[model samples]
Target: MILAFVLLFTASGLQASKAASCLSQQQIREAIDKKQIKHLAAIKAAVRKVVRGDVVRADVCNGNSGLVYELTILSRTGTVTRAIVDARTGSVLSKGF
Candidate 1:
């Protein structure tokens, strides 16, 4: 039983670390600047229009090759909205309504 508990705790820790590895603060900030995202409020507003309802969570997707700002926003309606914006041009590469 003790061994099983240890294994479970270890697995949880690994999972948390794996999620953290997806994105860093510096990368998200850099992506924002590169894309010329001047205001978080504007981004949120636009996202809310498509997502509908409050944003429950937001995260940046890293290691996108040449793409930048892979924004994942979870809406209060339990919808997961994804948008990929150009890092240098502030253009929306792809978005799903």
Candidate 2:
């Protein structure tokens, strides 16, 4: 059911359908400076607002629409979940995609 919910939400947009290539920390900083994507803090905050969990890891990756934040979260129940946030808009795109 959770997976179904995830798919339902992600199906609307935000395709990582292809192999998502992640950037290194240096590249991340460059992207931020170039205004290509939002700061990591903003991206992480966006996900935290939608998902009740601690963001353990966050990475900027190329998505179908544009840049996206790929986050690994540790839920209150100790379950690990992945989420995606739009880099520019800070919108939650996927919860388990």
Candidate 3:
């Protein structure tokens, strides 16, 4: 019985973590309306200043530093760049090639 309980608890925790990581369209709109996050265009511009590339995909997620915009960009040299931008202030937080 104790083993079963532990398994159940672990499953619940994993599910909660997965749910927290996902952002729905409505949640995104609400964040924007509340001024809790910046617009995508602003995030892209901020990222572009640090990394020259065409944005291929992007997502708004809660990171260790609060809300952030994660962008995947394809550079002219055929390299991929990953950039994290502050969702609220539209600043480039980090980048990786």
Clashes of each: 0, 0, 0
lDDT on C-alpha atoms for all candidate structures: 0.59, 0.81, 0.86
User: What is the TM-score of each predicted model, taking all chains together?
Assistant: 0.42, 0.72, 0.75
**Least accurate stretch of 10 residues (summed lDDT) in model 1?**
54-63
User: Tens-digit lDDT track for model 3 on 27-97?
Assistant: 88899999999878878877777899899988788888788887889999999988988899998888996
Name every residue pair that clashes in candidate 2.
Answer: none
Best-to-worst order by lDDT is 3, 2, 1
What order do candidates take by TM-score, descending? 3, 2, 1
Q: After superposing candidate 1, which stretches have Cα over 4 Å from the reference?
A: 1-21, 36-39, 63-97
Candidate 3 or 1, higher TM-score: 3
lDDT of 2 at 33: 95
lDDT of 2: 0.81
Q: Over the stretch 1-97, how does candidate 1's per-residue lDDT look in tens digits? A: 9999999999999869757754576766775677634335555655555455554444544435553455666667677777765444445667764
